[model samples]
Target: MPQATALYTAKTKRCEARKKKRRMTEPTQTESPDTTPLILDVDGTLLRTDMLYESLWAAAGRNIAATLKTCVTQWRAPNLLKHALCEIAAPNVALLPLRPAVLDLADAARQAGRAVHLASGSDQALVEAVAQRLDLPGPHFGSDATRNLTEQSKAQMLVERFGEGGFDYVGNSNADLPVWSKARRIIAVSPGGTLRHRLEAMGKPLEVVEDRSDPFALLREMRPHQWIKNLLLFLPLLVAHEFGLSVFLAALMAAAAFSIGASAIYILNDLLDLESDRLHPEKRNRPIASGALQIRNAMIASAGLVVLALTSAWLVGPPVAALTLLYMLTSLTYSFWLKKRRWIDLASLAFMFLLRVLTGAVAAQIAVPGVVMAFVFVVFFTLACVKRMTALARDVDHGKLPGRGYGADDFRALKVLAAAGIVLSAAAFLLYAFSGHSGGLYGSQMIFAATVLPLTLWLFRVVRLSELGREDYDPIQFVTHDRIGLMIMVIGVALVILSL
Candidate 1:
């Protein structure tokens, strides 16, 4: 009996020694005055953008077909989708838009002898890369093939690691609600109105980090100023001398429809070009590239705009609707495929502008002379080339233009081609004026012919400005904003009106 007791005592002592060893190795609640670690939510908290979406954009940019295939294959496995996207994307950590305030807070916490951890729903590899790039001190926890570490899962992990109410959480979205409830302190970074309301309801002490987002961020994303380009839809109505109320209304509706569709395409382009835009000098300020707008919200807005555009197109007429559909399909093709093809991209832009005129003609039920259409095509093509040349000048030092499949050597060729296009445009305009079409439409052929002089001067000025590297990348934008271009436009319009 004594031997058995001795054995039991020996087993008890062994267990006690093991417990003591664990106590020595594990961190204690009182290890330091700042025992609670700062747990950062990577997406929208530590970083201004979501890494998962950023990775998806990069993957799509690399090979859209492969990215789509991977997404389909892993539709039911989000963690695997994230991993696959990360592998394909291989994002540059230094280029990501990080929130300075959140980063400063994390650094301060670390300096205060508190642990700092990055907890995110992003793939493990992506999280590790960002943490390492920022030189973060603590370990990172991220989603893997089996689990997506977010919301409740993130809260559960923190509770398991540090115990409930033992850590501080920094997050931005409503999804962080559960984690915030579990955290001892809530640090809100750019919390929206709904999140602010919820935090107030919780009656918990909170630290607010201002987002510094532009107040007109959504409008900027929609690019309302770019809608001015859709005025091309009115050219046919004006040139055909159809000023009746019905024709005017149809043209207006067509313009609105095109604007809506163009805005949708712009949003999609921004999403696809996020990585490339981040590398660009000026384009990096775009709302999506700068992380001022969320990807999911942008996607929703784009879808909504497309629906509105289609509905408005249908209201105009069947032919107008068909033309609008064609424009959308062509634009989609350009965004997805042709935009990456050097010369083809310029041709596609010119074609889209011509389609706007065609749409206007259909909406107004007016005939546009074939020669006039040819002039429009050539002029728009020259302008498109000029835009490309300006972009090439800016990006030549990089050897290759971002998002565009053009090399530095192509600049001289593009300039030569643009000059040829300008000559062709002038010839087309002269042919239209002398071919008797203008005499049939206008009271005086000489007056109509005189309009070409201002047009030539305007085109020359545009080309010279572009060559001097003093033009906007968008030629239409430059024409709309430049004082000399606007003056020339007004004079040309006045001459055309006199001829009519």
Candidate 2:
């Protein structure tokens, strides 16, 4: 079976842009008769995503053992591997982002008594399923047990079925150039970069249907705003009062490495949450969930980001690299299994934050205080509960929580847990006021201790907003847009400077 290497992969498929009105470049004035079949490519033509990658992720996320077993047994045959994966975890056709332009075109053709066909490099079973989903009446073709049908092979199939220059084709990539060469008419739907010009180079009259995808979608998918959480990596340096260039650079390195690595994990989480995210009120709008980004492209980006993170961490020294790897492994574990378990998910989230602080200390060669670790654990645990509370509260407002395993009866326990966590975190913050580490490092320990008042008030406000369902899923991002959060942050920073 075709399989993903990672544990439970995430999928963020965008549908909005794929269905938008297209900007036509040139209309195809076809000379072909009504008897001619209108052929469509499944991946990136009828759908916004590639079925191969989608099913692979689906299998890895939902049916890992079956998929892995198939992979080990059928690794020699590409077609068999693909068919095996589909049997294990075929994507929900109803949930896939079917391109409206292509669907509309197919409908118009059908209304005119013309035949419509599905031809793709995806496995034959999947192609037939897609044709069945459309209820189209005509032939459908895909790669079989012995051969992968693509490029020249696809061109050959069309030639044998309809003769060279007898069929009309809709395609979106350079790989389709060979197929287009034999078609009487060509239609391009949201063609990849430079594909239009290349199609034009073929000297064939082209009908272009453009879907204006966000040019910066990949960056948005990386979620740069959430990188602010990595700023916590500097906590050890600040608390240690180590302003030296080497240590400062070390802290920055650790933070950057963590930021990139965390993004990879977030992408994984997004993929695994695809179906659930589609049901969510707010999460459905995310670039990945909304089909604003392609699944294969997201996977490629995630893999690249993982490499960048690990290489960067290695540059930060062995200890930092080890810690970064630990964080990533824990995050993947959380995504794959721990998240499905009660309380364990929240504890893992909190522990991840502690790992960040610990990595910072290791990178900067700082001797971390015990209270600092305690403060991180309780405070982040409180925030984790706050996140859950915010989600549950929204469920109360919306009547259902899409992906959460929690229900109405669990709400009271969640509140109690959050409340207890808040009280404990507050107690920890108070202890920070009297921490011997602070007094020894800061010039004005009293000023440093005074910062606690605003910090405590900030935490309280965060919890209150969560209770009201006014906070975003991510507290850090919510704080970025919150005036009170900014004010408290400014005051806290000023107080820290005075202490320094």
lDDT of 2 at 422: 68
* C-alpha TM-score for every candidate: 0.89, 0.84
- Return the clash pairs for model 1, or none: none
- At residue 162, candidate 2 shows an lDDT of 93
Poorest lDDT segment (10 consecutive residues) of candidate 2: 5-14
Best by TM-score: 1
Note the clash tally of each candidate: 0, 12
